[model samples]
Target: MTENDSSAPAPDRAPALPPVADRAAFEAELDALRVREKAHTREGDAIAAARRRLPMVEVDAGLELTGPDGPVTLLDAFEGRRQLIAYYFMWHEGHDAAGQCEGCTWVTNQVRELSFLHSRDITYAVFCQGPYEESRRYREFMGWDMRWYSALPSNNELLTGRQVGSMHIVCYVRDGDRVYETYWTTLRGVEVMDYNYALMDMTVYGRQELWEDSPSGWPQTMDAPPEHPMRTNGRPIPQWSRIEAGRSDDLTPGP
Candidate 1:
């Protein structure tokens, strides 16, 4: 058959396909899975409840971070809000935009429309591991308007025992002038910022990443190793659109 023909599988390789079933059979299978889905959702809610109850640790309110207006403290970053969600963005110092962290770009680009969090009296910001001026240019290139700051100077104190240079989400709450860290997560935990992965999980192909437990012949094009799955053509997938749209990817400070 020709490549366009869908009637038969190619002789060289078996096409990946899900087993076909009648509507009744499909509904029966779906209903069975729905029970587990509901349970998973409820368990998630319970876990969130537990997270809310977890005790917080005190962090120095005077910890310095470099913002647009120069030096600002951790307390200042909250912008007078009672709560804060800080994404500790990984950075590759001295590298151009394309050489920066792809995983960080994957999650950070998804964070738009912060009014929902602001409505709840929460502030969201990025604490980048690179210098403010250089990284701020990156933020502009990526079209991010949410607050951005350089956490490099305060990295030793802020990250402390945690691994530096890794992507992290840290939750904080303040009372008067005292700041406390309520929760923190890294690696796949940062997936909370991603809607793409969540939606892909519901699709038949499911992320197309090699790490998943997909059946034989299922397309797993997102393989990794020297490069990340979130990247395409040497840059993060999202950067391509911005570059194509004539946006500058230069991280150098403008005059």
Candidate 2:
């Protein structure tokens, strides 16, 4: 093993055996698991149906945002498509601003294979919750090139049932050329970004969330600290403005 791997492969070599084995039991178990999972899903589906029927109040106000390409409209954000999902990334510039909302960054990191989401005609992007001029720099510094725009005025429309300033998920469906704010949920909705983590945390496979069924099982990683070199250059990077100005190399997450 090398420094990175820390473990060596077994030196013993054994004759390969035929791979064929009884799979009926395994198949049955997998089928049972699927059925059990579907039961859990049905509850969510029922709630979603009720949420969908909830009356939607229209807002005449429009918001302006800029993407990697340039200035774009809220409707243009749909990119002539149907359906859109936006993550409200809280970005208030500061060094390792936990104020950016750790959960928001966690969800951001968890997103994967969005091309499938696109194939489903779902246009997903991040609507940054801050001044574009301020958030843009941090976005670029973090190398996040997604469709980001400012939360002009305020993001009240997207965060109806959610607490003010809380991390959230706002989903929309575009009809024809117009966009309609469909289902939007905060707190719990962010779980969709966790991929398989939450699902696997049960019984023999417990969730990484704090209250694990098995105390014997190792605890899941709850807080993921910033990875940027703790100390930049010889100076501490205490502000996003400086880091965006090519001073990230000088960042030092407070000692």
Candidate 3:
């Protein structure tokens, strides 16, 4: 029968499995891996310590960003907090919700709890690249409650020397009225906001993506279509749930 034929019986295939081992053998292997994992964790802590000591650059505190209450300065985004974590959300000028950046959606969707950050005097917000009203609707559709603002007018000044259209996690601190950019990271660096990836890393298949080094016969279709792994059925994977829940993805302004 043809591959697409419904009447075709499923081909008999052996399941890909790890070699069987006794409980003691498995525990011994796990114990050895724990040593490497502990070392890796310590290295991560060291890197963060170095990051904390890095010098910061002064930014135009008065740079304009459009908020729900109209235009506001970058300093205002801190909301009286000592520090701010602004996510520069990539935008498609005229794309609908389904056409938005899947990677950004994936990371942004995972940021739900802010009280933990707030307790440490840090505020988290999104500085979107699209128009305020247009992107605000998208935010509403996705049920995101984080502070949202349009950084389009101040993109050049706010993200100087950085690619403005890409996703970024910029950290800032306020000294009285002066705003200083402490640190910023993009690309995989933004994975710090993702719990899914962290959990997937613990799985036997390890994200099940093309880049992972897996045993033969392991499934690697997580990167299917090869271009957008975070997307499914022409939309970001998370957007499908919002759509199914009867939320509006229309970005157009309402009457």
Candidate 4:
């Protein structure tokens, strides 16, 4: 049957499976695939090594940012660490939390731990592209306890010729009182912030996103009724959990 016809009527039921093979033949094919997997892992390591060696650019360390504790310098966000990784969280001015960027939420939600980064003399924080009061409420609503700062007033200085109000992952290095931009990535490059996508890659059906090239009869409804893989109830899939848990989606003006 075709992929569209293969989807089970119920979500709990299994869809379709790949062709069956003899035990020895299956093992032999898997062994060959394992070799390719190892090579892919090695190449990833090589790419990371190359990324580490890229030259950095100096940024104004005195750029202003607003946090829960009020105004702070960009250097201060580093929190006395040797390195800093800041996520440029996109925002919709005056909109409620539900209207915020889904792509940003999808990735940022995975960054729940920072102790490991601290162990490596690194600090991680979010440089939100809106008012601190509104965005921080969204952060609390989503149950994220990470350090967050509003970069709205200083986006020009921080982004420096790049597009502002867009999601970006920027790496920085501290040299005494000076700060330098080591690397910055956006779009698919920022997928590193996603654990769900990484885990989905290991599954048989994969992410089931429309763009993915899956085997015939694969159980993916990408772009059919759902359209995007990240949405379900007219909102990002993650927001549903918060909504179900009775979290407020309001970040509108005046509380």
Candidate 3 per-residue C-alpha lDDT over 1-255 given as tens digits, one digit per residue, 9 for 90 to 100: 333332243366343788999999999999999999999999999999999999999998999999998999999999999999999999997778988889899999999999999999999999999899999999998899999999999998888999989999999999999999999999999999999889989987677677778999876654236667787667887787777777876787887
Q: Would you list the rank order by lDDT, best first?
A: 1, 3, 4, 2
lDDT of 4: 0.84
RMSD of each: 4.7, 8.7, 4.4, 4.4
lDDT winner between candidates 2 and 4:
4
Provide the global lDDT of candidate 1 against the true structure.
0.89
TM-score of 3: 0.93
Q: Tell me the deviation in Å of residue 175 in model 4.
A: 0.3
Model 2, runs deviating above 4 Å: 1-35, 45-55, 66-71, 97-99, 157-161, 176-178, 199-205, 216-255
Separately for all candidates shown, the number of backbone clashes (residues 3 or more apart, or on different chains) is: 0, 8, 0, 0
TM-score of each: 0.92, 0.63, 0.93, 0.91
Q: State the lDDT of candidate 1 residue by residue for 76-176, as single tens digits.
A: 99999999999999998788889899999999999999999999999999999999999999999999999999998899899988999999999999999
- The local distance difference test score of each candidate is 0.89, 0.59, 0.88, 0.84
> What's the distance in Å from true for residue 91, model 4?
0.7
lDDT by residue (tens digit), candidate 4, 47-147: 99999999999999999999878899999999999999999999998887667888888888999888999999999999999998999988988889999
lDDT of 3: 0.88
